[model samples]
Target: MINKKLIAPFYERLSLVLIGILALGFIIVQGKEILDPLMFGFLFAILLLPVSGFFEQKLRMPRSASSFLAIILLVAFVGGVLYR
Candidate 1:
């Protein structure tokens, strides 16, 4: 036999969790357009990190110089892809 006392709080907590999940989902859906580019830029920066580090360490370039060179390399690579 199940106890009546334990069931009430359990149901209450479960409902709260479900409501929280639904609310989070609603917020993400509402902000999709604004969030998409920010996420893309973040991933793009991640992709550039290794190439930037190589320029900074092996080539002994300054941080800003290396990063700018990395951006140039990225542009050139992208342009070549588009051309071909």
Candidate 2:
């Protein structure tokens, strides 16, 4: 009772399900080892370093103050996006 006309649609649906299952399995298996925490730390440190130095060299504010300012700016930007 299998209709020949239905074969292409059936294969297309099967291919999509297979690809999704593979992607889900990969994420479940490698979510931690493949992703980065130290990479984030390094990037954040590099970004703030210049801003902190700008304060110390030009404005004469302490590193801690510059870091706080950067964090506040980041929070404001993120909050604006979320609110909108």
Give me the candidate number with maximum TM-score. 1
Model 1 global lDDT (CA atoms, 0 to 1):
0.92
Residue-by-residue lDDT tens digits, candidate 1, 1-84: 976654558789999999999999999999999899999989879999999999999999999999999999999999999995
lDDT of 2 by residue, 50-81 (tens): 77778778998887888888777767887999
Worst ten in a row by lDDT for model 1: 2-11
Off by over 4 Å in 2: 1-35
Over 4 Å off, model 1: 1-8
> Residue 20, candidate 1: how far off, in angstroms?
1.1
TM-score to true structure, per model: 0.81, 0.48
| Clashing residue pairs, backbone N/CA/C < 3 A, model 1 | none
